[model samples]
Target: MEGDLERNNHILGDRWESMMSGHMTRIANEKGLDAQNFRCADCTSPIGIFYGAPRLCWYTGEYYCQNCHLMEENMIPARIIHNWDFRKHKVSKRTMVYLTQQWRDPCIQMDEVNPSGYRYIDELKKLLPLRLQLATLEPYLQTCRMLTPELLSTRLKGLHHMLGNPHIYSPHDLCLVRDGLLYNAINKLVQFGTKHVRQCALCTAKGFVCEICGKDEIIFAFDDMTSQCQQCKGVFHKRCFADRCPRCERRHNRNTPL
Candidate 1:
């Protein structure tokens, strides 16, 4: 079974490479430049480093931001890419950083279901990273106004409608909404934001499972400080597994989420 899973992963990795190569070629052709000189598919900026490496697309093999990459993977609502033209809503540098921290980055790797019963996922606490949540309420908050809980819920429901009512929308419809949203959101942020940093792709916890406890849920996702073993690429809840890898029996330093 483990072998099969590894085989599948290998196959997926190869397919991703092929598709990405094709994507880059297409972009290069569109822009009349070699893929090597091309910038991020969304931002068109030179790649920068974070966590000590140039931020390259896992699929596209191009420099890209974590937020845009997550949007590409549907980790966040693709619609947010288009929900508002952030370029038009520009603020000063100080305010921009504050807003990015408070309103923007939070939405990156957000869970599908939010605390206020405004959920994109049917199950509670089942995460859909990069999907927006109460952070969607940020624009309203910045206006120095408050949305009653009921109003917030109503607005969420309405946004869900604009995204084709994911609750009742067919799987195909959901894909369409996500694709559209991603394009719009990525285009705007790459153009407007003052700072761009590479975020680790694994931070999303998309396929992570705990080796020590054998439960996936409640394991850490972005910046939650979960412990990881470098050699085995295995993750564990810090409290459950400490100092040694249960699978490899290797004793080494554990890394915390960034």
Candidate 2:
């Protein structure tokens, strides 16, 4: 009976420690942690309370000794993900290194992680449409044989990845977005791509004239005023195509072998 009691006590102690450790790791600010619980989270060193308490890392909300902390400052990923806060805060050496390495990785899913960021952040709201526009214009720009790599490089600068996939956003990209710098860059890129598509002869040849309206105006699939048929890939003016694509019906009739 005594042996079983001792084993249970050990199990309970381990569980309590694990819970506390998780809670400490997730604490966002110093206020969440007790001053009496000060210890180096990394090295498990007990810092002297009278001589000097361990430094608090803003990122992990845990205290660390001087050897572990190194007084490094970095932007907290949790703060950025939750509050859209871009301010740099004092962090531990390990946190600083981890965030620096993750800066360029497209791992943050803004919509899934913090949907409110788009609704609250005016810059993010503005940037979304610009990215969508660039995404739409990408196919036209990519398929055009006349477009030079130098011209595209000059226009797109460092945003070529956005054309392929606009949903993914890196921490570095988010920082620029928060600063209102990326918005202007994406806007300019969309404008440049749109102008090229509309003016270039090869690109214009790929545009479709609205079959319903019978207008000579060239319209691309990306145009907001146009709608596309899922079956035949026919493009028509949104107003004219209302419920169905007449071109699809006509094509079906022709292919029926009457």
Candidate 3:
């Protein structure tokens, strides 16, 4: 019976849980509950990094522990990206402010359901790299806020109709609940580029039309003997990688993470 119980627990282990918010009481609120401590209730170790979990508090915007809170939506982080029309080049700087301020909102409109809830290899398969998505979305976020407030309202309505169930909506539904709500906020900002523009990621130099020019002038993205990372197909002059690997490529072993 003990072995059977262990097997059952392991099977249940992989499920996503979203209720760990303990109903959004402050960190102090759930203290000493024993039933809802932040540690792994099973192994009793610290799991306090507090990352993505499906269970979120509708009241407080907080990520919960998944291990102790099984059978609920596993909150994995996903950064939402959208088009923004802001013309400023401060993608990196603006993103920092937007994120800090936006992190406090309620998860109002998103859903944490497995995009294909019952079919994927893991229930939390929709989980994406938080930093990766955030980085990608930063370039487009600042200008999305320029959208007329009406469009934002209409978009929310469309989402509500698309995913909201009769009784409960997952915390993921809220712009606040998602990893890069700022990305989405900026996605809705006004956008202006057209006819395609390619710029040097390193120097932000613009208007290079040829790969050779890109290779010789910019000094990266060329696959010279010294400039290759196993992760990204980015080829660079040897000096580029030795100085700093371009974002496109980095060394990764079979077991290594990208």
Estimate every model's Cα lDDT from 0 to 1: 0.37, 0.76, 0.32
Q: Give lDDT: candidate 3, residue 245.
A: 44
Q: After superposition, how far is residue 254 of candidate 1 from its true place, in Å?
A: 22
The model with the greater TM-score, 2 or 3, is: 2
Cα displacement (angstroms), candidate 3, residue 22, comes to 4.1
State model 1's lDDT: 0.37
Best model per lDDT: 2
For model 2, what is the alpha-carbon lDDT of residue 83?
71
- Could you arrange the candidates by lDDT from highest to lowest? 2, 1, 3
Cα deviation at 217, candidate 3, in Å, is: 9.2
Question: Which candidate should be chosen as best, given TM-score against the real structure?
Answer: 2
Reference-based lDDT, residue 13, model 3: 55
Q: On a 0 to 1 TM-score scale, where does candidate 3 land against the true structure?
A: 0.22
Per-residue lDDT of candidate 1, residues 115-163 (tens digit): 3323533321121222322222233222322335564344343333322
Off by over 4 Å in 2: 1-39, 48-51, 227-235, 241-258
Q: What is the lDDT of residue 41 in candidate 2?
A: 70
How does each model score on TM-score? 0.19, 0.73, 0.22
Name the lDDT of candidate 2.
0.76
| Count of residue pairs whose backbone atoms collide, per candidate | 13, 0, 32
Error in Å for residue 95 of model 1: 33
